[model samples]
Target chain A: MSAIAAGVTGNNPALNIGIFAVFVAITLVVVFRASRNTKTAADYYAAGRAFTGPQNGIAISGDYLSAASFLGIAGAIALNGYDGFLYSIGFLVAWLVALLLVAELLRNTGKYTMGDVLAFRMRQRPVRAAAATSTLVVSFFYLLAQMAGAGGLVALLLGITNKTGQAVVIAAVGLIMIVYVLVGGMKGTTWVQIIKAALLITGALAMTIWVLAKFGFNLSSLLGGAVDAGGKTGEALLSPGKQYGATGTSKLDFLSLGLALVLGTAGLPHILMRFYTVPTAKEARRSVVWAIWLIGIFYLFTLVLGYGAGAIVGPEAIRAAPGKANSAAPLLAQALGGPVLLGLIAAVAFATILAVVAGLTITASASFAHDIYANIIKKDKLADKNAEVRVARITAVVIGIVAIVGGIVANGQNVAFLVALAFAVAASANLPTILYSLFWKRFNTSGALWSTYGGLVASIVLIVFSPAVSGKPATASTPSMIQGVDFHWFPLENPGIVSIPLAFFLGWLGTVLSKERRADKYAEMEVRALTGAGAEKATPH
Target chain B: MSTSHDPGTRPDPDEPDWAEVHGSAEFVELRRRLRRFVFPMTAVFLVWYLVYVLLADYAHGFMATKLVGDINVGLVLGLLQFVSTFVITSLYVRYADRKLDPLATSIRERVEGGAAK
Candidate 1:
C-alpha cells in the first residue's frame, strides 16, 4: 500500500519547507499576543468561554478535520475510488450525531473537559481518575497518530530524505505546539484554528475548481477522465470492491469502521472540548450547525480533489512511491498552478497540523493538571487558581515531549489508520460513560468507573490482537503484523463492533449489581444536562 | 466556573436549588421533547448509513449501477448522506426552538427566581 513515488524532480523542496516556516512564525506571533490574556485556568482550558457560535463553529471544524481528512482521505479516494468517499461520509455524518445528541447537552452539563461530565453525578475522586485516564488514553493515541503521520508527511513532501532532518522537523513541530498551548492557551489556539480552517478550505476549493474547470464542470467527465487514465482498471475504480469488499471479512471490517466513525465523533475529547468554548446551550447547538455545514462542504470538495488527482495525476504516478496518496492534494496544486499554488497548500497543511496538535495538547494537559493532579491528587488546592494554571502549562510541556517521542516511534504509520484507532478508543471507552452519566437515572459511581476503565482496557487489548496491527507489508495500509510476530486474534480491523457494546454492558451490569444507588442525584444531573438549570457560567478573563 | 476555584468540587449552594428544578414539570417536558427527537433520529440515521455501508460492501453491482450518463447509484447515494445530515440539523434546530427551548427557559426562570430570593 505504500506507494514508492517515482520521478520526484528532487529539485530543492526547500520552497515547501520555507512556506511551512512562514506559517510557524505567524502562529507564534499570535500565540505571543494571546498569552497576555491567559492568566487563569478558565482562559487556559476553555478560552474564557467568549467565542461566538460562528467563531467556535469554525474552530470546531478545524479541530475535527485534521490531516487525516484533508490529506489521508483524499489520498484514499485517489487510490481506492468509491470506498474513499465512504470515509468522508462517515466523518460528516458523525458530526450530526454530535450536533444532535451530544453538543448542547455536553456544554450545559460540563464545564471543562469531557471528564467534567463523567464526574458530574458520581463520586468525584474515582470517577475523575477514570475520566482522566480515558481522556489521556484517547488523546495520546490521537496525538501520536497526528504527530507521527505529519512528521513523515512533511519530510517526504519536502523531499527531506535524511533521518536526522526528519527528526529535526518533528522536533520543531512538537516545540511549536507546546508554545501554542503554553502561550495562547485555548483562546490563542482558537484563532490559529480559525485561520488554518479558512486556508485549508480555500486550498481544497481552488484545487477542485481547477480540476473541474479542466473538464467543463461536468462530474461525469471527471469520472470518465479517471477511468480513461486508469485504462482497464478504470471502470473498477468507480466501484467498491477494488479497495474493500473483495474479501470475506470485508463486510465485518466495513461495519466496524462505520460504527467507529459515527459513534466516535461524539466521544472525542478534543472535539467535545470545543462545546465548552461557548457560553450557552443555544450557542453550543448553533456552533454545531455551523460545523456540519462547513465540514459537509469541505468533504464534498475532497471528493472532487481525490478523483481529479487520480484522473490528472494518474494512479501509476501516485503508486510510484508509498504514501504518495498523502501528497495527492499537494501534487494536484503543483499540477494546477505550479510551485506557488503548491506552496500555499503545503503551508496550509503545516498550519492545519499545528493547530490540531495544539488543540490536543491543551486538552490532554487539562485532563492531567485539572482533572488528575489538581482535582484528584490535591483536592484541597482547588482554590489555588494560579497554581492550577501553572501546573497545566507545565503539563503541556511534558505532553509535548511525549507526543514528539511517540511520533518518532510511530513514524511511517498511516495517518488515517492511526486516527481510526484513536476514534475506536473514544467511542468504546469514553462515550458510554458520558451517555450514562447524563441520561440513565440509576447510573452510579461504580458503573461510571467500571465502564470507563473497561472500555479503555478492552479497546487496547482488542486492537493489539486485531489483524490491523498484525497483518503484513508492515506499511500503514497493509494489514500489519507487529514486528513480524502476528499474534493475531481479532478479525475486524476496527474494535468498535466488540468494544463499544462491551463497555456499555459493563456499565449496565455494574449499576444493576452494585449495592449503592445514586437515584437522588440522577434527577438533578438530568435536569441540569437537559435544561441548563444551574449550569456553570462563563467568566471574563 | 463551577469548579474553577476548587478541584473535585461539589455543587455551589449559591447556585439554584437542583431538587426543585429536577421536580419541575417544565424540566420533565424538556427531557421528553428532546428524547423524541434524539432517540428516533439516532436510530433512523444509523440505519440509513448502515444501509449505505452494507450495499457498498455486499451489492457492488447495485452501488455501481449506472444511472443517467456516467453517474452511478453509488455516487448519488453517497451524496445523499450529506443532504440527510443538513436536513436533520435544520429539523433539530426548529424542534429545539419550538419545543425544547421554551421548556428550558421556564425551568431556568423558575430556578433563577427562587435562587434570587
Candidate 2:
C-alpha cells in the first residue's frame, strides 16, 4: 500500500500532459469544424436548435457533471463513506425536479436565455435586466469554482507543486475555454460536452469494472473490504452521521444543503439554456430523460470508484496525498493500472473542468449579450442581425479573463462553498421567478423583479453571514476558507431553507401589491408554454 | 413575440386567438392532465426524499441497521433514491406520450396552422 501511494504521488508528468494535449488537439479540430455553420444568433446561442434529444442529453450530462461531481463526490465518499453518497443522491434527484417541472415548459416558451421566458409576459426591460443579473452572478461563481478546481487538479496530476505553475495551468484552461466559446459558440461547446461526458463516463465505468473484478464481482466483498480498511470507524463509514451528524446544528446544516442541492439544478442558467438547443418541447423532454439516465449511471459508477479507492488504496494514503480526498480516483487509477491509467483518468478530469467552464462561459456571455445588451440596451431593434453573436463572442473573452483572475486569486482556497452558494442563489433567485412566470397568470414585472432580486440578495447575504464564510474554525479533516475570523451569525452553512421560501413569498406579495395585470399576455404565454403554440422555430443552418 | 396587447380590444386578425385557445376545453384538459401527474408526483418525491434525509440525519441507529454483509439501511435507501428517480422519469415519459402529447400536438397544430392561414 505504501509503495502504491508513493507511486501515485510520483506520477509521470510527461505522460499526463501528453494525453491531455492529444485530447485538446482533437477537441479543437472538432470545435473548428462545428464553427463553420455559426452564422445567426440562433445558431450561436442555441446551436441553431439542431441537436437531437439524445445528443443534447449527453451534452447536458457533460455540462451538469462537473469535476465536482467526478472528483469531489468521489473523494467525499472515499473519506466519509455514506455521507459522500448523499451528495450524489441530491444531485441525481435534482434532475427529477428539472424534468417534471421546468424542462419542456421552458423550451416551449423561451428562445435563447431565461430572460426571454421571464420577460414574455411582464415588462421586458426590467425582467430581462434582473434575469441577466442573476444569470451572470450564478455563472461567475460557478466559473470561479471550476477554474480553481482546474489548478488543484493539475497540481495533483502533473505534480506541479509551485504556485506559478498552477496559475499558468489555470490561465491556459481559461484561454482554451474562451476559444471554444468564441469560435464554436453553443454548437462547438455542446459537442465538447458530449465528447467529455462520454469520456468521463467510460473512464469511470472502466475503473468501476476493474475495481469490481478485483473483488470477484461481489459488491458485498467490496463493501467488506472498505469496512475492514476503514479501521476503528469502519461501522460508522457504512452509515450516515460521519460527516453531517456531529451536533443538532450540523444536522440542520445537512438538511439545508440537501434542499439547495435538490432545488438548485432546475434553476441553473447553463442547464436551463441546454433546453433551448433542442428543437421541440418533446425533444427537450427526451433530452432531460436522457440526461437523467446518463447522469444517474455515472453517479452509480462514482459509488464503486469511491469505495474502491477506500478499500484498495486505503484512507490514510488518500489523506496524505496532495489534493487529499480529491486524489482518490487518480490514485485508484494508479493502483489499478499504473501511470497509463492515471494519465487517461487525469485527462478526463481536465476535460470535465474544461467542458463545464466552457458551458458556463457561453451561458453567461449569452445572457449578457442577449438579455442585457440586445434586448434591453438595443430594445430588440438591432439593425444588424449578426451583432448579437459578435457581442456574445466579446463577452466570452471578457468573462474568460475575469474567471482566470478569480481562479488565480482563489486557487488552493476552500471554494467548495462557492458551488453550493451558486446552487443556493439559483434555487432562491431563479427557480421561483421561473415557476411564477410559467404557472401564475397574475405574475407581473413587479413580481418578477421582486422574486429575482429578493432571492438573489437574500441568498448571497445569508451565505456571507453563514458559517461557511467566516466563523468556522479549521478542524482535523477540513480547513476553513478564512482563518481566525468569527463573525458569522447564520447557523447553517447553506441558506436555501430560508431563502427559497422567502423568494416565493416575495414574488406573490409583489404581484398582489402592484396593479400590473396583463391577462392577455398571460394567456399567450400559457398557450405557448403548454401547447408549444409560438415557440421558437428551429433555424438549422 | 409582441408584448403590446390592448386588454379590452380584439387581437390582430393575423394572430391566433390565444385567449380563446387558453379557455378551450382541450387546452384546459391538457393542463389538468399535466398538473394531475406532475404536482402529485412532485409532492410524493419531495416528501419521500425528506424522509430519507431525516433518517440519515437523525435516525442513525435505524439507518445503520445491517441488512446483509456490510449492506445497511442507509446505503439501500440512498440507492433507492436513484431507483425512484428513474421510475418517476420513465412513468412521466410514458404518461406524456400516451395521454398528453396527442392532445398538445392537436392544439399546437390548430393554433399554428390557423395563424399561417
Candidate 3:
C-alpha cells in the first residue's frame, strides 16, 4: 500500500491495476452480452426467473458481504475484540428471519418489488404509494452509503487525499454501476454478485488459513495472543461491551441495534428482490439453505480474520486514524500475503461495493417505474411492454445520478452510520408492512399504509433528533453546537426498539379501527403464499 | 411481459376459490403440520437467542466466566447460536420433505378439483 501510495509500486501496482482492470473488463463484457438477452420486462427485472436455487443463493450472499462485513467487522474485532464479533453474529442470525419467513414466500408472491407483495392483497394505489416511499428511502440511503464508502476506499488504495481524485473514483464507480443494471439488468447483476461472492469467499478463506497456520493451527492460542497484545487494556479487549457499552446506554443501544440487524434484511428492497430471480418456491427454500451454508462458512473466516488482525496488526496501528479500523483486514493482508494479495483484496472489496450498489439501483428503478410511475401515475395507460422497460431504464439513470451526487456530497460523512440508519428504517417501516400483509387476516390497506408511512417517518424523525446524527459534546469550551446541536433528545443510535414496535402498533390499530375486514384477502394470500398454486410463473424462455 | 399478471385479485375459474381451499381437510392438515414445526421452532429460537443477548448485556461476569483455559461461557453460547440455526434449518427441511411437501401437493390437487383425500 505504501509503495502504491508513494507512486513507487513499480511492480506491485501492475498486479493490482491489472487485476482491477481485468475484473471490470470482464464485468463490462458480461453486461454487453447480457444486453442482447434483456428483451422483455421480466427478463430485465428478474433474468426471466431462470436462476437455480444454488445460483441465486450464491448471488444472495454476494448481494450481502459488503465492505462493512469484509472490512468493518475485521476492524471492530481488531480494535474491540469480542464485541466486534457481535455485529457479525447478529448479521448471521438475521438470515433466520429471511429464510423462514421472507425468502420462499417472496419468491412465490412478487414479480418485481416489495410493493408487489404488499400491494398484492391491499388497495393498490395507496399501498403502493407507501411502499414506494419506503423503498426509495432505504435504497437511496444505502446507495449513498456504498458510494461514499467507495470514494474513501479508492482514496485509501491510491494513497491520495485529493478531493478531485476521490470525486473521480466515485464517478467512475457510479457510472459502472449504472451501466451494469441498464445494460445487463438482473442477469448482469446476478453474475457480478456470483463472481464477487466467489472472490470474497476465496480471499477470506486464504487469509484465514494463512492466519491459522501461522499460529500452528492452534485457535485458542491465537486468541490468547490477542489478549496479551494489549499492554494495559487487555481485559477490555476480551469483554462484551467495548463497542456498544461503556456509554451508560449500552443495553438499550445493543438491543435496538440487534433488532435492526435481525429484522432489517427482511425489509431491504435489493435482498427481497433476489427472490423474484429464482424459478420456484422449492428453489427459493433451497436457496436460503444454500445461503445459510455459504454465509456461515464465510463468517467462520471473518472471525479468524478479525482475531488474526488483532493479534498481527495490533490495536494501536489500527487506531492510528480516526476511522482507520476498517483498514485492519487490509493491513493484515499486506502483512500475510505481501502487496500482491493486498491488491487482490482491494479489487475484491471494490467488486463488493459495485455489486451491492448495482442491486440497489435495479431495485429502486423497479419500484419507481413499476410501482409509482406505471401503477400509480400512469395507471390508465394501456399496458405497453416497451414503455415499462423504457421507463425503468430511464429511472435507473436518474437514480444513478442522484446516488452519485449524494455520494460525492456526503463524502466526509460517516458512511457506517448511514448504513445503520438504512437498516433501522427498513426494520421499522418495511418489515412491519410485509409481516402484516403476509400473516394477519385483519390487515387492511389502512394498516399497511399507516405502518409503511408511519415507520418511515417515525424512524427518520427520531434519527434527526438523535445524538448519533450530530453528537452533542459537553462543556462549551469543548466545541459548539456544530459538534452536535443540543436539541438532540433521542437516546439510542438505532430507532428499531422504538420505531419498529410503533410501526407494528400503528398497523394493528389502523386495522382494528378501520371498517374494512378483508378476510377474503387473507384467505387468498394464505393459499398463494403457502402453496404457490396461483402465483406468478417464471417467464417461459 | 412488462405488466404483472394480476392473478390473485380474481381467482381463476378452474381452481376452487381460496375460501374452499381454506376449508378443505388437506389444507387444514397442511396448516396444522406446518405450524407444529414452525411455531415451536420460532418461539424457542427467539427466546433462546434473546436470553443470550440479554445475558451478554446485563450479566457481564456470567458471560465472561472462563470454563476452559482462555475460553468462556460467552464463547460457548456464541458458538451454539450457529449450531442451533443449522439444527433448526436441517430439522425443518427434513420435516417439510417428509410431511409438508406431500400435504401441499394433496392440497393443490384438491384445490384443482381432484379426488378427495
Candidate 4:
C-alpha cells in the first residue's frame, strides 16, 4: 500500500527541495530589499533603533516561540498532560521577569548585546570578548536544536532521508538566515520574526480549535480516552505514567524541566537583544504586555493540540519518533487532514526554524562584529558607519558557517535537549551579569567577567559530563560508559540550578575584589546611558 | 546625542553641573522606590520558583492531601505558580504607578528643561 501510494505520487524528493527553495528565495529577496537603507553598526545590530512598540514586541515573541515551543511542548502535553502544561506555565511566567526587570533596563542601558550591559561600566576588551564568546556559544547551541528539528521534520514530512536530508535542511535554513541578517540586518530579522510568529500562532490556534471541536469539547473524556490508549501505566496520554512518568525516580525530572523553562526564558541572549531594537523603556514594557497575551493564548492552543494528537493518532506513532517527538504536531495535522494542511504545517515549521535561526545568527554576528572585532580587538577604530555595516555582513557569513558545522556535528540529538543546553548556558552566562549590572552599584568589570566566565565554564563542564553527552555504543543504550557515573547524580537532564547561582556568586566576588572607583568613568558612562545622553556625545558606529 | 533645538528636551552641551540639571526630589524618591520594589519582587519570584520545584518533587506524599474531589493542596500549589506570577506583576505595576511614574515624569521634565536652557 505504501509503495503504491508512493508510486502514484511519483514522489519526487526534488519537489520538496524546490518547495523549500522557493521560501528561501522569497525570504532572501525581502531581506535584501530591507537592507538597502541599513547604514550604520546600530542599523545593522539594532535596525537604527527604529522599531515601533508593537512591531518589536511581536518580533520579541516571535524570536522566542521556536520549534521547541511549537512542537516539543505540544507533543509533551499530548503524551503527558499536566506535566507538559507545566512547561508552558514555566515559560510564560519568566516573561514577568523580562517585562518588569530586564526589558526596560536592558533598553535604557545597553547598546546591542548583553556584553554591552556588562561592558558599560568596565573596560572594552574583557567585556566585549566575554560578551561575544557567550553570544556565539549560546547561538551555536540554539542553532543546533533548530537544525535538528528541521532535519527531523524534513524526514517525516518530505520523506527525505533522515541523515543527508538533515544536513541539507540545516544548510538551507542556515543560508536563508545568513542572507536575512546580511541584507536586512536587524530590520529584516525583526520583520521575518513578526511574520513567522503570526503564522505559527494562528496555525497552532486553528489546529487546536479543530481538535477540540472533534472531541466534542469534552476535556475529561478526551483525556480519559488517551489514558486508556496509553495502556498499563496509563502513561500513554494525558498523564505521566505511560513512559516518561517516574518509575522509581523521585520526580527530579519534573523539577529540572520546570527550572529550565522558567529561569531559562529570562536568560536567553537572542531574546534579550530584541529589547535593544525598541526606542524606549516604556515601549519595551508595553510590548511585553502584548507578548504575554499572545504567548498565553498560543500556549493554551498547544494543550488542545497535544491532547488531540494523543486521542486521535494514538501513542504508538509518538513512540515511533521518541527522539523526534517534536514532530508530533505536524504529523497529527497530516493524519487529520489532507496533504495540503500537512504541507502548510510543514512550511510553517520550516519558517519557524528559519526565523529563530536568523535571530540567533544575527545576535552572534553582532557580538562578533560590533563587540569583539570592531570594539574590543580593534578598540573602536572602525567607527565609520559604512565600514561597520560591511564588517557586520562578513561576520554574519562567518557565524553562519560555524553554526552549520556545529549543527551537523550535533545531528540526530533530541531537539529539546539542545534547547535546554542553550537555556542552561544563557542562564549561567548572561542573566547574572545583566541583573547585577542594572541593580548593583558595586558591580564592576572584574565581577562581570568572572560571572560570565564562571557560568560559561560550569554549565559547559556539567553538560559535557552529563549522560546526555555520553558517547555510549548505540546498541548498548544503557550508558555503558558508566563505571561510576549515572544521570541520577545530576537529577535534571540540564543543570541551571547549580550553574546560575555559581555565576551570581562569582560576579559578586569579582566586584568585591576590585578596587572601588566611586563616580568613576564607568559609572559616569552608566549615567549617560540611562539618560540617553551617551548617544549625543558620540555616534554609535 | 545630536544638536537638536527642540526645547524642553535633549541635554544642553553647556550644562556641566549635573546636580542643577537633575530632576526634583520627587523623581529621586521614585527611583529609590522602584529599586526597592524590584529587589523584593525578584526575591519573591525566586522563592516562588523554588517552591514549585520542591512541591512537584515531593507532591506524591501530598497529592492525596485534598481540599475537594481529586483537587488537593499539591495540585493547588502546582497551579499557584501561574497565580503568583500574575500577582507579582500586578503588584509591580501598581507600585510603579504609585511611586515610580511620577518621579520618572518629573525627571524627564527637568532633563528636558535643562536641555532647552
* Docking category of candidate 3: acceptable
Q: What is the lDDT of every predicted structure here?
A: 0.82, 0.91, 0.80, 0.69
Better of 1 and 4 by lDDT: 1
Please provide TM-scores computed only on chain A for all of the candidate models, following their numbering.
0.96, 0.99, 0.95, 0.89
lDDT per residue for candidate 2 within A1-541, as digits (tens), equals 6666566657798999899999999999999999999899999999999999999999999999999999999888889999999999999999998999999999998989999898988888999999999999999999999988887887889888889999999999889999999999999999999999999999999999999999999888898898899999876778999999999999998998999999999999999999999999999999999999999999999999999999998899998888889999999998899899999999999999999999999999999999988888998788886888889999999999999999999999998999999999999999999989988898899999999999999999988888788866788345557879877898888899999999999999999999999999888888888889868778846
- Which residue pairs show backbone clashes in model 3? none
lDDT of 4 by residue, A1-541 (tens): 2332232123344544565566667767778777886877677788877777788878877888888888888887766655676677778888887877787767766777777776766766887788788888888888877876666666666676557767887787777778788778998999888878887888887787778777677655666666665666443333233333464332655565566667677778888888888776666666777787678778778877886777676656665653335656866776666565666677777888889988988888777777877676666655455766677688889878877776776665544566778888888888888888776767888998899999999888877766565544435422322334444334445677778889999999988999954345444444443444333211232
True-contact fraction in model 3 equals: 0.33
TM-score, one value per model: 0.96, 0.98, 0.94, 0.87
Show how many residue pairs clash in every candidate, following the order shown: 18, 0, 0, 5
Quick one: best lDDT, which candidate? 2
Candidate 2 Cα RMSD after full superposition onto the native fold (Å): 2.1
**Candidate that beats the other on TM-score, 2 or 3, i.e. the better one:** 2
* Candidate 4, Cα interface RMSD: 4.8
Tens digits of per-residue lDDT for model 1 on A1-541?
1232433324247777788888788878987888788777777798888889999999998998898899888888888888889999999999877877788889987878887888877778898888888889888888988888876676657777666777888888898888888889999999889989988988888788889999999999999898888887889878776777768886778888888998899999999998888889899998999999999999999999989988988877776643567877776777788777777887888788889999999998888888888878887356667888888899999999999888877777544566788888888888898888777888888898788889889988988887777765555457473656777888877888899999999999988887777665776677777778767667775
TM-score of chain B of each: 0.84, 0.90, 0.82, 0.71
Residue A336 shift from truth in candidate 4, angstroms? 2.6
Off by over 4 Å in 4: A1-29, A235-250, A253-257, A321-323, A471-492, A520-541, B1-24, B61-99, B115-117
lDDT value, residue A503 of candidate 4: 93
For the record, the alpha-carbon RMSD of candidate 4 to the native fold, in angstroms, is 4.6
